[model samples]
Target: MDAVAKEIEGLTFNMLTFNVVNDKITQGFANRIIQIIEKHNIDQVIVIADEVEEPAQFLLNLASAARSICISQTCASYWGGEPLFLGAHELSWAPGMFERKMDKLFIDNRLFLEFLDTEDIKMLRERLPKIDKKIWFASTCLIHGLYGLNYENNGCVVQSCISDGNEVERGLISITHSSRQDERFKSLVKLREYHFIPYPALACYIEY
Candidate 1:
């Protein structure tokens, strides 16, 4: 984990993702994120909810977790809460001319999420003229490509996975490796890497 984070921090455009949905290495997926923030000395973070099973819960935690969290102000309104930074100029790109060959939504309904609609994205584009784009920052979210999960220079992509084990049994980590270019995995590979693998493999994130 230390190595992974370091490699990411070294990026020309530094970035990383968290499967708040699942921790690919130890258990306590929730606390593990908090630990990562402290361990890596991360100052700000973005939390993206892949599914809506618990948006409020995640947001509440996110609110408490970051130094100050910034979300799509529109999504905050849709969820009925005011975010610290409600205006994200980047939200402007409402997705266009998708080249994906699968799914009818790819052609017609590109907006994609419950709270994220094309209209909000369009509105964001309108306000973008005022926001400068020269800043470099780290983002942690479950959001798809529009959120910038892929590291183009290295041709590296961020992936996530979850386990289906019973409540009593610790679930295995689900590792979905895909091209950083693909929005969410069109397909996935489930490995017991999270709970089953040796933690040393995660030399990328942890210190010896």
Candidate 2:
């Protein structure tokens, strides 16, 4: 197996390739995967490696129940683009600004159900039953009844932040540059085993 495949096997997360020419799954890869699985008490995992010009769609299969989700961005050494996908919904994006009126906020469900590719969802459900249970959206995306698809399941809960029953995706911005001045991000880190999702420019904020 190649170095990349070996490292992936060591992590014990299932591997999928995108637009990569070397599509060889060597015996070494299978052996290493078994060894890692035997060594750890793992419940579920899904890992994806992308080598194409296409967007990183593998992120859509992230383990929501997991306390932390790690992404090694190979696109541009820096991260920044489309503040969307920072919510608890599958194949959905949050609005730019939330309008609040009469103590109740108006957050629309801008769902592209056409993006709900049933085959992909089925594949994920088969591999990881608890997929997309709770998403790692930004604390800012929290607007009432704005949880996109996550709400359809069972409302939603915010981890590592204030526990609000609202279904909004989030709009809580992360403080950048001054690590000392960012109380909200600091508080989030204090929570036990919080989920880790990365925004392009805000990727630096995730301590772990």
Candidate 3:
């Protein structure tokens, strides 16, 4: 924590990505982030890593301070671009399928639904029920049961992977350097287990 004060010598930071919903961002802390960003003359910032409903206000505050900000729709990364919304929703059709259940977990959040554009809403409503059933069944099935999908139940909700959510068909996808990737000639696709489907109970914010 002391590092924030030491390294922050009015540097021109390219980004300041915070997990908005995380408890670390109390009112006083939020104000301090604003102060730090402003003091550093940050160019732009990436939105909170995953959905933490409470920190929405803090994110908005940072956006106001930075020149621009972009939140991942699911986990969309940008190399360079104007601020935009990210809507990353994934699902599978078959019951007992792991991927399908993961998608439903993301959709149930009220904050997620609110940010989703019209197209996103349309896509989710059509796929929700089928996706939910599979995961629900899997939760009970001892052989196939992967366990609960929440922090309390020893399972966590996976947020982003390939954006399409077609892991079996598409292979693993890791989101790197978001928008403006075309110009930077960067690889947006990555392969990593750090962000995988069927979340675990432990939630550690190690740089993905």
Candidate 4:
């Protein structure tokens, strides 16, 4: 039992969940989120709730566990509370966009968590404007190609992964390899701006 517990101790995961509704975000909803996290031993989470009225209080209530949080751009007025400087940004993009491709929201939210966890604030800030286009997981290659143009001018794309450094490298290299053979992937990296650092392979944002 002790050995099993030890093994479990090493396991942790970043989670993402959305409460998409027209009603205001409430404390009960927040509590339920905490319950779910504890139940799964979640290390971190990205809570995406929409149309929160008291954004400040809602966030403050979650101050204990929510390592990285995001509210919709439409909720801007309610966010007048003290900002945690935790990548608190306006979700100015169309809701339908995220509704269709939820994985992109998960990735975008986790990117903020990674920046906070790795203390790569400067890189995040510098790349913030560019993220909306490149990091967004589009449903089509045409979108990827259009965004790839901006990605090249901005330099390299760096992102976090669940695996070790070498694995990250292999994954990225695989993508580049596919770019050569797959028409969609090919257009995405046409500029060769596909140069990317899948850290912890690069180990630090400075290397990007």
Candidate 5:
């Protein structure tokens, strides 16, 4: 498990990412996130996970434990399981998908392009300046395109997966406008290699 904490502006941001091995490990990771939230007195928490049943369940467990909010491609109301603590928001680019329940909203590169065509993209660019709220961009890898598209005052959290031989590792890279030019922060945008294979992979080959 790996974790990093940084204070951006006046808010404390705790970023954590890890491979999902089993229920035990996921529960432990949830506990670790809770510990970090308590230690730092973090007020806002955002948990993003794939739409798969197991991962979504794990995401709910972590969010429930931390009493934090969640954002995903689908609405939390559709996640249907244990109730969320602080409610949830869906990331949407289409006007029809927007709901009154969504108090906070953000956009991601994958979803933006998938939903919008050439003309839509151009129109969005023209009207972007008129929007008042800061739009956050979430990506699988920061080194890919969409690194600097976020508003100058807003920060971005990128969760990426790295596969090294049979071992798979996931990590979160948090970057703010203030730290964009810092050499130390820029150095983190490199490929990571892990030596040992996780125990769950011993029985079969897991393709990332």
Candidate 6:
């Protein structure tokens, strides 16, 4: 796998894209991500997974241990009123109640849309500016929908193809110069067993 880093207008953006052979995210994989965070000096970490599967739970716990901000989409069975399509069910700061050891912020994406106007997206954009540089660890399935939001906010996005199997469908794009090959980037490539490709801009539809 390849890790690409580029500096744009004083902001450092790094992109790591790889396929997850199977629908599994092992501890080894999560640890490698942590190493990348440290290697890049990531100031903020965002984990976005729609479902709290066993592997996703583990990743969340690990990210929390590293003091990362975690957000996941929750099942809609617990909603009491007319379902809202663009907001979170709850944002909790305590740990242990959820399957993870960190704060549990759950969004309701039952009527999931490929738009950048959702409350969670807004929340993400708001929180991103707090850190000068940040990285996002999201589900590959959600990357298509989130790319626009991440680009507009100027944050690095990373994802493993857990739900999408071994095919990585899209790549994050930046209007910056070509990526620079550095020691950290080489280490990231060595950390992954999957074949890595540097950043490639793929078109995604984003509703207004």
C-alpha root-mean-square deviation, each candidate: 15.9, 14.4, 16.0, 16.2, 13.3, 13.9
Model 6's TM-score against the true structure: 0.27
Off by over 4 Å in 2: 7-52, 61-136, 139-208
Write the number of the candidate with greater TM-score, choosing between 3 and 5.
3
In model 1, how many backbone clashes occur?
12
Which regions of candidate 4 are displaced past 4 Å? 1-13, 74-208
The residue-by-residue lDDT of candidate 2 on 1-208, one tens digit each, is 3464456554644223222222322334434433443344333322222122222222222222222333221221122332222222243211111110111011111221122234433332232223223222232333223233221222222222212334223322211112123321211221222223323223323342
lDDT of 4 by residue, 76-158 (tens): 22435422222233322322232222213222221122212222322332443343343322111111111212232243232
Top-TM-score candidate index: 3
Better of 1 and 3 by lDDT: 3
Deviation (Å) of 21 in candidate 3 = 9.1
What CA RMSD would candidate 5 show? 13.3
Lowest-lDDT window of 10 residues in candidate 4?
Answer: 138-147
**lDDT comparing candidate 6 with the true structure:** 0.32
- Listed in order, each prediction's TM-score against the native is 0.26, 0.25, 0.37, 0.29, 0.25, 0.27
- Output the number of the lDDT-best candidate: 3
Superposition TM-score, candidate 3 onto the true structure: 0.37
Report clash pairs, candidate 4: 73-91
How does residue 111 of candidate 5 score in lDDT? 19
Candidate 1 structure quality by residue, lDDT tens digits, 72-102? 2112234234222222223322211011111
Candidates 4 and 6 compared by lDDT, better number: 6
Ranking by TM-score: 3, 4, 6, 1, 5, 2
